[model samples]
Target: MKEDTPPPSSPPPLPVFKMPRVHKQEYWSFVRLVAPSTEMPPGQTAWKTTDAELAYCLKCKTTFKYRSGSSASIRKHMNHEHPHELGSVGREAAVKRMKNALASKRKSSAVIFSPTKRTKKINPAEEEMATRALIEWIAKCLRPLSIVEDEELRFFITLVQTMHGIYELPSRRTITERMQAHAQQLRSLLKEKNAEEVDFYSLTTDMWTSRTTDSYIALTIHFMTDFFELRSYTLEVASFCGKHTEVRIRRKLRDLMYTWG
Candidate 1:
């Protein structure tokens, strides 16, 4: 019989490399919403961020945590936990902003503000500013591009504008249209650069499941500059039906490459 050997010694502990700490002020993206200078839903004290992505809510009364990815969740928590904070004016402001947003649209590139019965004086400048801010906010964090039809969210933004003096937001249709145009513009620019600057390219593909248990695959392209700097960008993602078998993956890959190639 073979003698039992002693277990291998444990690997040395990982070096205690201290990561540089991020100050709250360094998170300028959240400055507009969480900073004391901007709007804060009543009953909530100034918010603080540790990782620049997750925020600690003082209004929560305890060490309440929420992601800065969606201001909607933060508002939902406030509405449920502190309903009294969102007063009458806040609600009315929301309704007014929604109404103003739903007013007829024009062919101009800028967001139009329509004056209604309740609020006779509509400031187009403010409306444009608010629209730009809202769209930019949604785009920056990769939030759902379909935030236009989110009425409850529109109301929250309206209430925020009450203190921040931002104008009423645009309608969902407008938001969608503007985002599409902006995306197209960016795509055109990127395609031009890739065709001009890059000589050769490589591709990477990933198959994964979403929260809803949907299977999908994303394709990313990689290239290098004359200086040997690497660059990568996701070209597109599509649903990969059936099992993630190699055959199925190969078929999908063929389809995408044939189309793009």
Candidate 2:
């Protein structure tokens, strides 16, 4: 009995099993990687004419076939005809996709080879010098192109080159065009901010006489918080009555206050 008890036999060893090896493809299949489209809805084509029998552009009044031509042409038609119906992001994405596709196709098919030599390491000082020189040149060109003010343009270009490491600046024309576009965007943003009674708080006034003996009137808005910290915007011309009469100035101030409120 004791001998049998002694052999009360060790419990069977737990079975060891190997986990199934997951292939990269199988793993990726389970992962949702594609970012949600902010431009257009899925299963829907942008700028495609509605179910109406006749495709008429409300903007340009031009008629075209449904889903015909390039997306750009379609978007252009919509912009000219149905500008109000098109969303901003949708139009932008369509134009960008078209431009990118065209550019990618036109790009030279030459094979680019990275330098094999270790001696071609980038020198930080040289890179910085090159970046600064390029930034200055960009600033000078931006003013005449009416893109942005010299200082602001320089700052922006410098920031882009320094932060993003875009060593090769685009053509001057392209830079100017882009800057002009961004300036327009800035103006639109300013308009939106002005439209919304956001952070506006106080008023700044300045009076000056022009060459034509006209008393030019200028006023600025000051925005402040409960912390008494002054905000950054310069004085914006609130009124230009041509004469700085007290009554006119007061009326203009009142109107501005009303609008701001």
Winner by TM-score: 1
> Model 2 over residues 1-261: C-alpha lDDT tens digits?
554522212321222111123222211121111112334446765323222222333233334432322234444555554443344444465656655654453352233535562224358999999868767876876635444457666545544533435466799999999988876665555556655644556667676766776665555666754587666454344436555678888887777556434
- Candidate 1 lands at a TM-score of 0.35
Alpha carbon lDDT of each predicted model: 0.58, 0.47
**After aligning candidate 2 to the native by TM-score, how far in Å is the CA of 188 from where it should be?**
5.3
Best by lDDT: 1
Over 4 Å off in model 2, which ranges? 1-150, 156-188, 191-200, 212-214, 225-228, 232-235, 238-242, 257-261
Tens digit per residue, CA lDDT, model 1, 1-261: 997643323221211111123232112211122232344457865444422332333343222233544455445555665553343335456656556654422122144446442333459998899889989999998889887879788756554644436566799999999998866665655676777787899999998898999999988899988999899988768898898888989989989776555
Error of 1 at 148 (Å): 23
